[model samples]
Target: MTAQALPPVVDAETWQRRLDELRAREKQATRQLDAVAARRRRMPMVEMPGYTLEGEEGPVELADVFGDKSQLIVYHHMWFPGEKWQCPGCTGFTSQFTRLGFLDGYDARFVVVTQGPIDEALTYKRRVGNRMTWYSTANSPFGAAVGAPAGGGFAVNVFLRDGRKVYRTWHTDGRGTEQLGHTFGLIDVLPYGRQEQWQDSPEGWPQSPTYSRWAGSEDIAARYGPDGGTA
Candidate 1:
């Protein structure tokens, strides 16, 4: 069957009412989310098994990486085959890590773990100029053992440790970006914004069909290898 004809455009006053309704619905959703976060915070404690992660100073235990911090957030970064490239979405989250002072105040640490060669990971780190730690799990079984998805995507995991071992409390998609979306932060101000490809945004929103690496006049192909861009 052919598609139905579109509805006529609403007047300005009607549009304003619709926007107010949208905002109200969003507020209710935010309250629900906050409640869920409170529940997650109460997750039972567990021990983190000791494993050496390849850090800037070579293999180091999980507890050692967190230093004196009480909590650890790990980003399981995807490393696609052969191109020596990292997930563009993962890189986007890493960009915000340096600016996060909440970690210090809350006794938490954040790090990105990838299955790429150390040199490639280090190069990506330098290119992005991020202060957060980046390490390799490509050769290590730490990622898979802790339930890394086989589909090769980004996973944000929150861990708590009791001495030498760490326990996972939460693992989520989209890098916990939903927490910052409503307040109109830097990500929302960007040309292609963050809610990823699944947002329920209005028509004519400036969502790119690909990552922002090629934003503006930059040539990403020469720098990020053949599999770069939306391919």
Candidate 2:
């Protein structure tokens, strides 16, 4: 990298002036996000089927997953059967959400629902030190109905409960779920930004292939295993 292309030294006033301009843009983006969320709040929801899922304790109904909470968020985690581990992207993404007790105050519950068997799913949960509660849709078509069929990619789904009935309000996959994981947002604020080739980073800033950092990352899971990401 050429020294000239690096982040240039600037007087404090010049830096603050540039920062003020960026802050204006940031605030505008925040307002736009609020608008999107407002629209989301008004979106129509579809009533869901009453399906039974396998929780760690045993079989559980869809509404029961909410545990008296009025709202539900499910991460349709991708799984590969007979393997010692599951999807690393799903693993790393879900791992970032631990001790999410604050959601209780909002009358909401968030949990993992996968097509993998309950036994193996829980095993992988402990293996990765993921702390989020997990459940299995191996027997029912729950995962398939909710956009994460067996052998498919990952997705995030939201639902609302009115008494015994459950309704799905929103669902998203691919990059749409990025907002839930703060790791990317935090990394993005850095000068280099995710450091991935796809990013529009400044010239001469560090860059790498997407997901290159996660390659051969079992040791990371092991490091978190004791304090635990845990069943």
Candidate 3:
């Protein structure tokens, strides 16, 4: 698909008008989502049951991984045993994970779990140059049991703590949909916006697919993956 082009001459007044319109819409959407979230907050919870993950030091329980936090956000990072490509959306979400502690003000701990064999996962993280808490569930039931699709990588999940018991709260699996939340912090001030070509906005704006900044991912997804341009 071809990109929509902007007119050669957009006056200052027109530009300001467009910016104001977008900001107004953004505020309205945020309120609507906040209302919807209040409803979702009442959804039933599922006991997580004891699960373990292979951390840098060794096996670590799911509950212990939260450090001192009461809430946990886990990204089911996509990295198969032999596959060269990980999920583009997951990568994008992970790129946002660097700001984990910033979300700590809300009592949350964010971690990325990969399906690659334990050592392979550690090695890959170094190769990709990510310092985030990368772990492997190769020996546990966490990945498959928690809605991470068959081959892996489809969701970012949040779990809550109640005394000694932990429960799953919410999860999401889509591009650009992540901007709906105000909890997680941003790693850097993005000067070019998202730079992704498929954002749900007017023409000529830039939005980089969340994961396009990763090594070799640009060729993996030419324009936010094959379906990015669509709604």
Candidate 2 lDDT over residue span 1-231, tens digit each: 453356888999999999999999999999999999999999999999999999999999999999979999999999888876677788888888888899989999999999999999987788777799999999999988988999999999999999999999999999999998888888778777777888887778778899876623265476666533333
Candidate 3 at 174: error in angstroms? 2.8
Candidate 1 matches the true fold with a TM-score of: 0.71
TM-score of every candidate: 0.71, 0.93, 0.71
Q: Which residue window of length 10 is worst by lDDT in model 2?
A: 222-231
- The segments of candidate 3 whose C-alpha lies over 4 angstroms from its true place after superposition are 1-4, 8-23, 83-89, 180-215, 218-231
lDDT of 1 by residue, 1-231 (tens): 632333348999998898799899989988998999899888775555676778887887877778888688887777776553456555554555556677789998888888776677776666555466888776677777665643467777778876776777777766365463233365665544564556555555545454543322112323332334333
* Residue lDDT tens for model 3, 105-195: 8888877787777777765555444557987888888888887754754567789987768899987765434653432224323333445
The global C-alpha lDDT for each of the candidates, from Candidate 1 onward, is 0.65, 0.87, 0.67
Runs in model 2 lying further than 4 Å from the true structure = 1-5, 215-217, 227-231
TM-score: model 2 vs. ground truth: 0.93
Better of 2 and 3 by lDDT: 2
**Cα RMSD of predicted structure 3:** 7.6
Choose 2 or 3, whichever is better by TM-score: 2
